[model samples]
Target: MTATMMTPAQLARFEARLLAERADAEERLAEFDGVMTEVRIARTDATADDEHDPEGPTMTQEWSQRSAVLADVRAELADVDRAIARIANGSYGVCTNCGKRITVARLDARPTAELCIDCARQAR
Candidate 1:
């Protein structure tokens, strides 16, 4: 693995931040899973026209939103895991797409980022 440009303090901070975010993401994923399961069960056992209910979002709509959130959280957790692995291998501050040092500000804002600003802009 390539040497990281980040100082030990910076690396430690980023690692801490990523770990915290990963924990939050995992919690959210679990919460979403529980809510999704509940909605599924409720919809399955419903005798009324839940699909056309006017009181609130239908079970299908709630499920869709929860599933989307769960997917995003899962992806974020994966990114955090990858970032932690990079940190362990001494490549945490290197941009995966461009082989350049990722800016400190960018890293501070998103500790799990793998691409530099240019690469990320291009990716979008």
Candidate 2:
């Protein structure tokens, strides 16, 4: 049987989802950037008195958290970008594993997925 194709409306909905996610990631990344900038400036100023810097440990902890969060946000952004590209290339819903059409349910659940459920299960 021929694979079910995505309708224009469905594709629009998916696009909106990807774009919304991308915006959210961007927001988080910007927040992370702000935190990182403050941390960097605080750490590098060299004038922060060593006598009893109350912010030292706090800054260090925040830096570590920001780094980890940045990593996660970047990964999610990459996935969203890939999904947008797939949509543009007319390969959005096709499973990379078996060349089957991925169900709308799966795509809605994971817009960045490249593999179908069966293939993903086998790979796991």
Candidate 3:
């Protein structure tokens, strides 16, 4: 099936959105890094007994939660970087799976999406 290509204006808007997303992801990653550093320091503190405190979550739990979030943000940043590369290579808004045009609405919601909705749903 033939698919309509995005106009230059649409591409520009999507690129801007993706760049903003990248920045947000980077900011989250930095925050996570700082928190992880603090957690590491707390873990090594001689006076703290997070493992047996029973007052709140343990240091390990906090580290695990923050690590998971950090990983997610890193993945998002990678996706944004890839989307930017696709725009640079004239492949933005095109589904990699079926070589079809991804709908503008989908792109608006997920500028880093590489597959069209149908292919994405099928992949699940």
- Report per-prediction Cα RMSD to one decimal: 2.7, 2.6, 2.8
TM-score of each: 0.86, 0.83, 0.87
- Per-residue error for 32 in candidate 1, Å, reads 1.2
The lDDT of model 3 is: 0.86
Q: Could you give candidate 1's per-residue lDDT for residues 1-124 as a string of tens digits? A: 3578778998899888988988888888888878888887787666355655563456568778878888888888899999999999998989898789888999888888899899999999
lDDT of 3 by residue, 34-100 (tens): 9898888777772365545553466568778888988899999999999999999888888999999
Better of 1 and 2 by TM-score: 1
Q: Write the per-residue lDDT of candidate 2 for residues 2-111, one digit (tens) a residue.
A: 34398989988999999999999999899889978878998866346574677777778887888998999999999999999988888888888788888899998998
- Go through the candidates in order and give each one's C-alpha lDDT: 0.84, 0.86, 0.86
- For model 1, state the Cα shift of residue 73 in Å: 0.9
Question: Pick by TM-score: which candidate is best?
Answer: 3
Off by over 4 Å in 1: 47-57
